[model samples]
Target chain A: MMLISAIILIIMIVILPLETGRFLERFDKGHQNDTGMVFLSGFLLQLVLFFPVALGTMFFIRQDNFVWCTRIYLILSCIPAIAGAVCRIRKLKEKKPAAGPERKAEVYKNTGEEKNGKFRDAEKTILWAAFFIILAYQLYKAVTTAFIDGDNTFYVTQSLIAQQQGVMFTNLPYTGGPTSLDMRHALAVLPLWFAYLAKVSGIHATVLCKTVMPLFLIPFTYLVFFEIAKRLYPEEKNNIPFFLCLVAVFEMFGSVSIYTSERFFLTRTWQGKAMLGSVVIPVIILALLMIAADIRDKSNANIKTAWYLIVSAGIFSGICTSLGVAFSALLTLGGCLVIAIRDRKPKLFAMSMLACIPQAVYMVLYVILK
Target chain B: MISRLWAYLELNIETVKNYAGTGFLLLIYAAAFAYLLISEKDKAKRVIFVWIPGLTLLFFFLPPVRWMYMKYIDGSATYYRVLWLIPVAMTIAHGFTRICEGFKLIGLPVAVALIALCGGDVYHSVAGPLVIASKAQNEYHIPQEVIETADIIMANEQGHRVKAVMPLDFTSYIRQYDTDLYLAYGRELIMRPDAYDELYSMLCEDPIDVEKMREAAIPRQVSYYVFPKTSGFVKDPESCGLEKAGETKDHVIYRDPEELEYMSGISYYYFTD
Candidate 1:
C-alpha cells in the first residue's frame, strides 16, 4: 500500500507534469527540447492552475474542512490535467500517421547531433554517473535518517490534523486545540496539499512528508538547476552534467549555517519555506534566463510564454509560502527591471509587473485578512 | 529611523556572516562573477551571470532598499534569503568549469578541491560528535521514547482527548503522533520569548513543588505529568495524588487520579461539544 501511494505520488508530481508540459511545449519553440523546462512549466502550470480553484473552494466551504476541500479540489483540478492529457493524446494521434518516417528521421538526426555535440563521451558519462550517485545518496539518507526540526510542530502537524480531522489550520498544532484562522498560514496551503496526498494514498502524513517527499523534491530541484545549466552553457552540453555534480556537492556541504537555502534543502526539504527557497527561486531564475535568451536572439516572438512562466512561478511561489510572494515578486520584477534597463526595453519591465498580478493579489489578501 | 537602519545593517551583516561561514564560497562566487563578467561573450548568459546578480547585491546592501524590505516584508533575520537571489553554486561551477576547460588535465581535480574546501561538511558537528543523520526511531522521525510515551498515555486515556503536561522536549512530537494528546502549553511558548504560561514555567522549574504543580494542573485539567527521571521535585508527586502510571526509558509518566476521574466524567461532554 505504501509503495503504491509513493508511486501514485511520483506519477502525480512527475508524469502528470510531464503531460502538462507536453501540452505547454506548443507555446515555445525553444523549450520544446528542454525536458527540464517542460517539466518545470508543467509543474508550475499545475500549481498556478490548482491554486485558484483550491482557494475558491476553500472560500465557498468557509469552514476550511480540508478533507472535502481536497476531495473537491482534486476532482476539479483534474479537469485541466485531463484536458492537458487529451490534448497531448490528440496531438500524438494527429502525428501518428506521419510519425513513422518523421520519428525515424528524428532519431537519425539525434544520433547525428549527438556525434557532433560538444558533450564528450567518457567525461560526460562519468559526470552523469557521479550526479546520479549523489542524488541516490541524498535519497538514501532522506529515507533512512531523520533530521528533526522545530517548525514541524506547525507544518507536519497541520498535515496530520487535516488528514486525521478533515479540518485545515483551524487547530493550533502545538496544543491540538481549536484556533482561529491564521490568515498568514491559511492561504499557504502546501501542508493541506500534503494532507490531500496522504488522504488519497492512505499513507500517514508524517511518513509522506519525512520519507517520501525528499525523494521527489531533491530531484525536482536538480531539474530546475539542470535547466539553469542548459541556459548557462547551452553550447557545451557536457558542462551541464558537471554543473549538476557541483550543485549536488555544494548542497551536500551547504550547511554552512542553519539559515542558508542549502541547509534548508538538506534538512527541511519537505517544508513550504524550503520549497520557495530551493525550487521556486531557481525556477524564477530560469524564467529570467529564458526571457533574456529570447530577447538577445531577437526571437522575441515566443517570449510571451516566458512571461507566462514568470506569472505561474509567481502564483506557485504564493502557493509554497506567503513569503514566497514577496521573494518571487522581488526576483521577477527586480530581475526584469534590470534586464529592461540594461537592454533598454521598457515593455519588458511592464510585462514583468503584469506577470506579478497573482502575487500582488495574494499580498492584498494576506494584508486585509492579517 | 537612521539608527534603526544602522542596527538593521549590523543584523544583516551578522546574518550574512552566519550564512557565508568562513566566507570561502562567497570569495569563490565573487571570483566566478568577475570572471563571467569579463570573459562571458554570450549576451543572454551575461544578463543572468552578471547583470541580475550585480543588481541584486546592490539592492541587498543599499540602505533604503534594506529599509523598505525590513519595513514591508520581514526583518534582518531572514534578510539572508536575499542573497539566495545570487546563483552562487551555478556561478562558481560555470566559472570554474570554464576556467578549467583551458587546463583540461588537472582542472577537474583542482575545481573539486576548491569546492570541497569552500564547503564545510554538512554533517560536520560544531559542538559534538558528527552524527547528523541517524536511523529514524519510527516512521514519524520523532524520538522512539515519544512514540512509547504516546502509546502509554493513549492506553491510559479515559477520554477521546486528554490534556497532559510533559517536558519541553516532547512538546512538539507528542501531538504529532496522536492529536488526542493535548499539551497544557507547547513549543510555541518555549520558542517565543514573549509567550508565557504559569503552569509551563512551574513544571520546568528545578525542584518543582508538587503541591504547586497540583494547583496549576487542576485548573488546566492536565491529567498526566511526564517528567525526565533526572528531574528534581520538592516532594514525591505521589504525595500530591499523581500516581506513577508508567515509565519509558527516559521519562516517568505520573497520572493525576483526581484529574483522570474528572476527565472521565466530563471528557465526552467537554470534547464532543
Candidate 2:
C-alpha cells in the first residue's frame, strides 16, 4: 500500500506537475526555452493551482471524515495531473509534424554551439560529481539534525495532523480545539498540503519532509540561483554549473555575526519558511530579472511570460509561509522599482504591481477570513 | 548598543571559522567582490550582486525599519535574516568567475582552496553535528528519548479521550501519542487550552492536596500525569489517587482516580469561574 502510494505521489506531484509545466511552456508559443526549465516552471504553477484547490476542499470537508476527505482531495487533484499529462501529449504530438525528426535535427544543429568554454568530458564529470556530492552532504546534515527542537515541533506536528487526521486549519493540532488557526497558522497551509501528499504517496511525512524535499528542492534551488546568475552574467552561461557546485560546497558558509541562508537551507529546508527564504524569494528575484531582460530587449511576449511566472511565484510564496506574501510583495515591488528607475522604464513599474496581485489577493482573503 | 554591533563581529568571525574553516571561502568571496568592483564595469551586475544583501544589511541596521518590522512582523530577526543567504552565496559565486579572470595566476589555487573549505564545512557543520546528534542518546543534542516517550503515551492511550498534566516540557506539543490524547501544557500560541495553570498550581499546592488534585484534574477531564523518571515534583502519585499505568525510559504515566471516574465531580471552576 505504501509503495503504491509512493508511486501515486511521484506521478501526481513530481511527474504530472512537471508535464503540466511542459504543456504550459508550449503556451509560451514561439519563445525559445528548454524542455527542462519549462517543466520546472510547472512546479511553481502546480503550487499556485494546487494551493487553492486543496485548501478549498479541506475547508468544506467533514472534520471527522479525514480519510474520506483526503481520498477525495487526492482524486480531485488527479484531475489536473491527468489533464496536464494529456495536454502535454497532445502538445507534443502537435509539435511533431510529419517530418518532425528532420526538423528536430535541424533545431539541434542550430542550438549545438557550446556557448561557454567547451568543457572536456572529465571537467563535466568533475562538475557533476561536485553537484551530487554537495547535495548528499546537505542531505546528511538535514537528515541528521534533530527535528525535535525549536519550531520543528510545530511543522512536524502539523504535517502529522494532516496525514493522520486529514485536518487543515480547523482542529488546531497543538492545542486541539475547533478554532480557526490564527493569522499566522491560517497562512501556512502548505505543510498540511504536504501531509496530504505524504499520506497519499505512502511515504512517511518525516522522510518526505526531511530527506526528500532537501534532496530535490536544494538542487532545484541551485537551478533557480543559476538562472539568477545567467541573468546577471548572460555571457558566462556555461560557468553557472561550476559556480553552483561552489554553492553546494559552501553550504555552511553563513556568517555567524548574522543569520544566513545556510542555517535554514541546511537545517530546515523542509519547513515552509525555509522554502520561502531559499526558493520562493530567489525565484521572485529571478522573475524580476527576466522581466527586466524582456523589457530591455523589447519583447512583449517574453514580458508576458515573465509576468505569469512572477505571479505564480507570488502565489506560491503566499501559500508557503505566513510572512511570505508580505515579503514577496515588498521584495518584488522594491526590486522592480529600483530596476525600473535605473533603466527608466516607468511601464515596468506597473507590470511589477501586477505581479503582486496573486499574493495580495491571497493575503486579503486570509485576513478577511480571520 | 553601538558596541553590541561590533561585539557580534567576533562571533560572526567565529561562525566563519567553525563553518568555513577560518573563512577562506569568505576571503575568496571578498576577493571575488573586490576584483569585480575594481575590474568589472557593468553597473547592473554590480547592483544585482549587492541587491539582496544590501537591503538585508540596511534592514538590519535601520532602527526605524526594525521598529516597523517588530510592530508589523510576527517572526524572528534571526530567522528572517535567512533572506540574505542565497543572495550572498550567489554573489560570491557570481563574482568568482570575475575573480578568476582578474587573478589568473593563482585561480587554480583559489579553486583548490574552496574545495578544501567545503570539505571542512561539511565535516564541522554537516557530518560532525550528525555524528554528535546520533550519539546524543541522553539528548543534550537530540531528544529522541522524549519523542519515543510521547509515542509510548499515545500507544497506551489507545484512542481514549485522555489529557495528561505534566511538566510543560514533557507534555509539550512534541509529545504526541494520538489526536485524542493531548498534553495539558502545550507550547506557545495554542488553541483551546484546558485550564493548565490552575491544575499545575493544584499539583504543586502545599502538603500535596489529594482530593483537590483529583477534583481539579480528572473532573476537569485531565486523565493522566506524565511524571519524569526521577521523582522530583509529584514524587508519589499513589497518595494522590493516581496509579502507574505505563512507563517509558524517560517518563512515567500515572492514571488519575485509579479506575473509571464514578463521580469525577463537576468541573465548573475548571472552565467558567
Candidate 3:
C-alpha cells in the first residue's frame, strides 16, 4: 500500500503535471526543449485553476466541497494533460527540424567550448558529484529527521481533517470543533491540495506532509534553480553544475535565522509560506527574465505567454500563501517598471498591472472578508 | 504617522538583521551584484541579477513602501518577504561562478571554504540539531508517546468518538492521527495570548485541580484525560469519577466512566459539535 501510494503521488505530482506542462510549451516556442519551464507551467496551471474552482465550489456547495473540488480539478486537469500527451505524440512523429542557432549553441557549448580552460570534464564531473551529494544529504535529513514546528498543529491537522472528514475549513484543525470558514487561510488552499493527494493516494496525511512532501519540494525547488542557472549561463554550461552546487550549499547553511527563506525551505518545505518564499518568488523572477529576453529580441509570439505566466504565477502565489498574493504583485510591478522605463515601453508596465489583476482581486476579497 | 513610520523602519531593520545573520551571505550577495553590474553583458542577465535586485533592495529599505505594505497588503511580520525578491542564492552562485570562471582548482576550494567559514551550520546551530530535527520514530513522524497515547484511547473507546482533555503536547498530534477524537482545548487557545478558556486552564494546570476540572468537564461531556506520568495532580483522578484506562510509556490515560455512560446514552455522530 505504501509503494502504491508513493507511485500514485509521483504520478499526480510529477508525471501528470509534466504532461500538462507540455501543452503550455506551445506558447513559448523558444523554450520547447526546456523541461523545467514545462514542469513549472503545468504546476502553476493546476494551482491557478484549483484556487477559483475550489473557492466557487466552497461558496456554492458548502458540504462535500472537498469531494466536488477534487473531482472537478482532477477532471479539468486531465484535459490539458491529455492534450499535452497528444502534442508530444505528434511532435515525436513529425520530421526532425534543423537545430536552430540557440539549440545548436546549447548542444555545442556543454562540451567543446571549454577545452583549453582549466575546468575539464573531470572537474565538471566533480562539481556534478558535489551537487548530487549535497542534494542527497538534504533529502536524507528531510526523510529521516522530524522537524516539529508549532504551526504544523494547524496546517497538518487541517490537511488530515479535510482528507478524513471530506470537509474544507468547516472543522477547526486544533480541536474537532466546528468553525466558520477561515477567510484568510481558506484562500490559500495548499493544505487542501495536500488533503487531495492523501485522499487519492491513501497515504496518511501526516506521513505524506512530513516525509513524502520534502522529497518532492526540495528537488522541485532545485529544478527551478537549475532552470535559473541555465538562463544565467546559457553559454557556460560547465558553470551550471557549480552554480547548482553553490545553491545547494547556500540552502544547506542558509539557516542564518529562523526567518530566512533558506531555513523555511529546509525546515518547513511542506508549508504554504515556505513555498511562497522559495518557489513562487523565484518563478516570478524567472518569468520576468523570460519576458525581458522576449521583449529585447522582439519575440512577441512567446512574450505574451510569459506575461500570462506572470498572471498565472500571481494566482499561484495566492494558492500557496496569502501574503504571496501581494509579494508576487509587488515583485512583478517592480521588475516590470524597471523594464518599462529602461526599454521605453510603457505598455510593459500596463501588462504587468494586468498580470496582477487576479492578485488584486484576491487582496480585495481578503479586505472585504476581513 | 511619523512615529509609526519610525517604528516600521525599526521593524524592517530588525527583519533585515535577522535575515542576514552574520551578514557573510549578504556580503557575498552584494559582491555578486557588483560583479554582475561590472561584467555581465547580457541585457536580460543585467536586468535580472543587477537592476531588479538593486531596485528591490531599495524598495525593501524604503520606510514608506513598507508602511504602505503593512497598512494595505499584509502585516509587518511578513515584510521581510520583500527581500525575498532579491534572489540571494542565485546572485551569489552566479557571481562566484563568474568570478571563478578561469581558476577551477583554486576557485572551488575558496568558494566551499568561504561558505563553510561564514555560514551557520544548520545541523549544529545554537539550539543544537535535536531541537531542529530528530529521527522520526514512526511513519507519521509523530512522537512515539503520542501514537501510544492515541492507541490507548482508541482501544478504550466505545462506539462514540472520543472527546478527551489532552495536555498541550498531545493536543496537536492526537487529532492529526485520529479526527474522530476531539480536544477540550486546542493549540490556538493557548498559543494566542488574547484567547482564554477556563476548562483548558484548569485541566492543563500543574497539580491539576481534579474536582474543579471534573465539574467543568462533565457538562462538556469530555470522556477521557491523557496526561504525562510526571504531571502533578491535586488528587488522583481515579479516586474521583474517572477510572484508570491504560498507560503509554510517557502518559497515563484515564477515562470518565460516568461521561462515557452519559455519551453512550445518546447517539453522537463524530461530526457533531
The top-ranked prediction according to DockQ is 3
What tens-digit string does per-residue lDDT give for candidate 1 at B1-273? 888778867766776788888788788888899899999988778877898899888778777777777778875457788888877877887787788763433566677777788777655523244445567777788889998988888887643677888888899888778777788889988688899888778877899887898887888888888988888999999998889989999899998877673332111101112
B1-273 per-residue lDDT for model 2 (tens digits): 756556544444443344444455556666665666676566556445555455554554454554455566543543344245326566666666565643422453476466454434322343333331232232112355555655665566655456667656544434232445565556752333554477666655554555566776765567677655654544356766677777877777777645432221111101011
CA lDDT of each prediction against the hidden true structure: 0.78, 0.60, 0.80
The best-first sequence of candidates by DockQ reads 3, 1, 2
- Number of the top lDDT candidate: 3
For every prediction, compared with the true complex, DockQ reads 0.47, 0.22, 0.51
**Compared with the true structure, what per-residue lDDT tens digits does model 2 show for residues A1-370?**
8578667867766786676666676577633345445655777776666675655555555444346546765666566667767876686687863332232211123577653333444454665566677677766656555433446556766676667555665555554544454445755667766777777776766557755656577767777776676567555433555677666655554423224456566666777777877788778777766766665666664565667767887788777786778787877787777678877888778878887887778777766765
lDDT of 2 at B187: 71
**Residue A8 error for model 1, in Å?**
2.8
Model 1: how far is A325 from its true place, Å?
Answer: 1.1
State model 2's lDDT. 0.60
Interface RMSD for candidate 2 relative to the native interface:
7.0
True-structure RMSD for candidate 1: 4.2
Q: Which ten residues in a row have the lowest lDDT in candidate 3 chain B?
A: B263-272
Tens digits of per-residue lDDT for model 3 on B235-260?
A: 88888888998998888899988867
Write the number of the candidate with greater lDDT, choosing between 1 and 2: 1
